[model samples]
Target chain A: MDKLRQHIEDITALSDEEYAYIKTFFTAKKVRKGQYLLSEGDDARYEYLVLSGIYKVFYIDEQGREFILQFAKENWWMSDYEAFFREKKATVFIECIDAGEVLVNTLQTREKLATEFHKMEHFYRAKLTNGYIALQQRIKLLLSSTPQERYETFSKMYPDLGQRLPKKIIAEYLGVSRETLSRLYSR
Target chain B: MDKLRQHIEDITALSDEEYAYIKTFFTAKKVRKGQYLLSEGDDARYEYLVLSGIYKVFYIDEQGREFILQFAKENWWMSDYEAFFREKKATVFIECIDAGEVLVNTLQTREKLATEFHKMEHFYRAKLTNGYIALQQRIKLLLSSTPQERYETFSKMYPDLGQRLPKKIIAEYLGVSRETLSRLYSR
Candidate 1:
């Protein structure tokens, strides 16, 4: 897709021929709202590059409580990465929050692309670097930030997401109760 | 050093000539106990690969409370990655808990190595993948796990770290009070 080529180009340039070859590794799929891309116990065979849509990556606990790990939007990548990389069954679920399209590639295809094209490897490495930094910030926020601070930081960092996401889901992501989120909203 | 070469080789094969060139990008440093590799407001230019030693990556909050983000031992990489990647001042601290040696490489050097050698890029990407999964697990623990569950999981995951680290540090890492951690230890 053009979006995929643009995303890759943001990190590394690719020739038209190279882009054509690279595009073959990915297959596009349309997802409807509430559609589950992955769920616990399924083989996490593909990593997705979002073209347009919002999705939630989450896990259900022993008590059936849901914990949202992250939200992926356009140009974002999402999968049960632990499972995907290790060739294991999924321990998480990825559900489409809005109808949209995504390009999916298997780990084998990803590795092949990276190996065949040095630029692709560079692009993936760069993306991973950004992902790693974001995760580090998430850990810091979880460990040190107060609920209000967390809400404010989330709002500031993802103003668009804040406006688009339901308060209930936002509360879950912030690890705050709905009532607390409402109170913060009022303030 | 040999350790660095071996670390890289674990993920991808490299020629002696390649390893020789790769080693030049890294500088070895011996860290004394209680020495700070990085501190808040300092330029976070280099990422360290621990050769031998224990280190804590942490930050002190406005309330003067310390939060441990991660602990690095041999063969592990540590940095104020958010700052290091962004080429900005650090908001976190990395300090030696036990005297050890580290291989330090600047952002420029790291990028150069990755760009010059596709194998190096693959190695870095694999490392980031593992780190990303670990952080995802940490987020899951923080969002859903009880304190006791956290303590048990940490102990199980890093039994050596459980024995090597101070109870206070472990408590901070788990986001539990010292007394609570002690109680968990007793149980």
Candidate 2:
């Protein structure tokens, strides 16, 4: 919970009372590696804030092929946001990659917190601004960049994630074949 | 500025005084067809809220091939958001496809408005939330869907955009060849 306090404080200060109230909106959950927090067809009822672990948000296509949408690490937020925001059934799965705990909150809690606290609303807006920029960059890479350029950009942007994630998963994220990834890796 | 007022009021009600102050932060510009609002290497200082007309946000790669990122219509916001938010040089171009008017504001103006008005903050946050979801859906389409599925989903989600945009532009946006797009259209 202290980490949660620090995370919010990084953007805006909160009184002890406010922090206490905000903490109540979130419940702690421990997830082990290979465990799924969310799966397709389930209700995406809660969004998770990573405390100390890694998770991948992804969807499997008709042919059972997986496409990684995002990776959430410590302090990052994860959910099938399109489903979560629209209060729809999940089309994506959030699976734990490393054993750790996360703080989960429902959409009602998120809105209630933001509505009750202006600072919290600002914090959320700031976070969304950064997320929007990241997705824009991702779209640009998807639309324009070559395999080699993509690999280099991904490595530069997420060197820690590169070290932590498996090569196969990294290859999928970069939209490159395993052979191509291996060639790039050797280079 | 009635459109701007209505756009914000759709999310939250604002007092006349608040609207007056808010409108002052934005300046209106009329864009002629084929004119560029932003281009690569230019300073992306302001974000635009479309009043009337159509605009395409895109980039040209090293091979001189164009990739369309998004099309903005009336009431839509368009910018090189990554650059606009970070105060960096634009990496994308925004050009008017059909003559239209837009309200433009700088990051400083946006931050000031949000800081001074809680409702404005909420409005911006709501817009970002929607944009974020749209981008997520786009990533899903790009990563997992077949070309046909992508085209169908796109047509379903944006029937107006589909009708307004040319087949070649739609093909580029969907990452399909012109022949593939034409075949899909005929089907």
Q: Pick the candidate with the highest TM-score.
A: 1
- Segments of candidate 2 deviating more than 4 angstroms: none
- Per-residue C-alpha lDDT of model 2 across residues A40-109, encoded as one tens digit per residue: 9999999999998899998888888888899899999999998999999999999999999999999998
Worst 10 residues of 2 chain B by lDDT: B137-146
lDDT of 1 by residue, B52-109 (tens): 9999999999999999999999999999998998989999999999999999999999
Sequence-dependent TM-score of model 2 = 0.95
User: DockQ for all models, in order?
Assistant: 0.89, 0.83
lDDT of each: 0.93, 0.92
Q: How far off is model 2, as Cα RMSD?
A: 1.7
The TM-score between candidate 1 and the true structure equals: 0.98
DockQ for the candidate 2 complex? 0.83
Give fnat of each prediction, in order. 0.85, 0.78
Per-residue lDDT of candidate 1, residues A1-187 (tens digit): 4898889999888899999999888999999999999999999999999999999999989988888899999999999999999999999999999899999999999989989989888888889889988988999999999999999999999899999989999998888778999998788
